[model samples]
Target: MTFAIGIFDLFTYTISGSIYLAFLGYLVVRLHWVDIGALAGTPVPTLIVFVLLSYLLGYVAYPVGAVVNRVVPRRRERHPRQEFLRRVPTAQDRDYVQADPFLLLSALQLHDKDAAAEVTRLRASGLMLRNCAPPLALGFVAAIVELFLSRTPAMAAGCAVLLAVGFFSLIVQARRLSHWARMKTLELCFWLPDIDERYRVDRNAGGGSSPNNE
Candidate 1:
């Protein structure tokens, strides 16, 4: 039962990880710079270069997507449990829309190692072991299964390539999210104003005027 829960938990967090890689691959092809090949036909060199570019792009694209997916939700989620104190929802797994961001922000700033304590504190507090790491492992498992179970050489190769792209993207995104969370810690901690300042001068929906907001 625990293992089954673990598997389900892993899948939920990995949403959007695969799709990002395909998008990244398309971006790589669109930006591929090899002009030596014929405009109409891909030459051996161009094909090789394109493949290399695709591989490299997946490395970057996946990470960027991961950063965007994780951080945006973290920063935006509002707390229903506490009007002033909210939790980060990604790793929480209880209620998505009800999550508060500040609760998460405080947690990350405390637990992480690289002063990334801020980011790590935020990266799905309870779900670190439960959520973040498993999908990466599963992606690898799927890749291996495809490589061995495939019957035809071409199909096997295609699966291998697609699987690689997808998995690679997930990892990149994971790493990038951590990085962005760290950076965001710095940004929110030092640069951004308190929520009151951000919404300055306006009366809140709860009918309270913000201090220094005017």
Candidate 2:
């Protein structure tokens, strides 16, 4: 599971990084900083270099993802714990009300491995979507610049519109996936008898700690 998660992380980073690199490439070409025509002659070497740089750029773009998350704000609705408590009357009596939803989810994972895996997968996908938004936004800006620079303004304008739609869709889907993952976690805990029993016992025994109080 850990290895799989790591691979997913790499895949997400590579995709987002590639888009970011493309954005940079567009800017470079527009500015006449590098002649891509010459680079195209050595296609093999260029592809190899691009692949390597994309992976490296993936790491660099991670902080950009963090900034995107902050700007987008995951908690657009009530916190997951609050939502869970509202939905499940029994949960209101437990430490889950005050406990961080993420921590509580982690604790629930100890008792429900399969459901935990699904939650992990959902969150990973959401993260990828979130990270990709910035690069797409950059690409949209590049397209707008292209509109001004290119002889065919219509083509560039079309590309910009497509990118703009893609950027908006990615943000919307990312938020939905994140919310789904959280709600799924709470739902799984409520439905699974053994997991619910274990979680309730743990919280009642003072195993769960509230983040605010800490």
Candidate 3:
């Protein structure tokens, strides 16, 4: 069942990622990188292949971006730009952020310096992947538009308009993710980890016992 759900999730993301990639295609068309009329002469089957390829590329972007992030040296922000609810976050904020599995186990509970480092690396990688989506989306859109522009101008125009609207929504989602990644990094820095059973029991009844106990 879990495996099936994972498959479903991957398919959903692939299609969604591809749609966003269409935004990239839109930009390319607007920039005249590829003449739309030229695509009109291309065979219908080839155009279909182009559309599929764009989607595949967008889906691939996530892992590629993540890998690139691991290679890149990230600059630490001494302080994140966003204002917190308080100069010192309240217990509620701390609890909320620590609910994240990576922050909780990797940073707080273990307090292993290496774990903290890994968390930071993962966050940086995630940010890069999110940032890559829009540009890739635009690229995909441009290709589709160019391929169909001459043969199906109306269809091409409609796709462009629709994708343009969706692109705005994607931009909002990407920004939100960026903010979350920043706040998570800041939260990791401030939180103190206590893996004691007493503390865990008081905070969360379901919080598991120490691994050594098992």
Best by TM-score: 2
Give model 2 RMSD, 1 decimal.
4.7
The sequence of per-residue lDDT tens digits that candidate 2 reaches over residues 1-214 is 1212264565567667787888888778878899979776776767767776877787788778767666764445536677777778787665344545577577668777777888887877877787888988887887788799889999989998998888778877877788788778777766645554565577788776554210
Q: After superposition, which runs of candidate 1 have C-alpha atoms over 4 Å from their true positions?
A: 1-104, 107-150, 191-214
Cα displacement (Å) at residue 171, model 1: 1.5
**What is the clash tally of candidate 1?**
11
Clashing pairs in 2: none
Candidate 2, run of 10 with poorest lDDT: 1-10
- Give the 10-residue window scoring lowest on summed lDDT in candidate 3: 1-10
Ranking, lDDT, top scorer first: 2, 3, 1
TM-score of 2: 0.72
Score candidate 3 by TM-score against the native: 0.36
Q: For model 3, how does the per-residue alpha-carbon lDDT over 35-124 read when each residue is reduced to its tens digit?
A: 878766899778666556645665566554444334434444222323443455464334433343343434443555654554444444
What ranking of all candidate models by TM-score puts the best one first? Answer: 2, 3, 1
Q: Note each model's CA RMSD in angstroms.
A: 15.1, 4.7, 12.2
Q: Quantify all predictions' global Cα lDDT against the true fold.
A: 0.40, 0.72, 0.48
Which sections of candidate 2 miss by over 4 Å?
1-7, 28-52, 72-79, 85-90, 191-214
How many angstroms is residue 116 displaced in model 2 relative to the true structure, after the best TM-score fit?
1.6
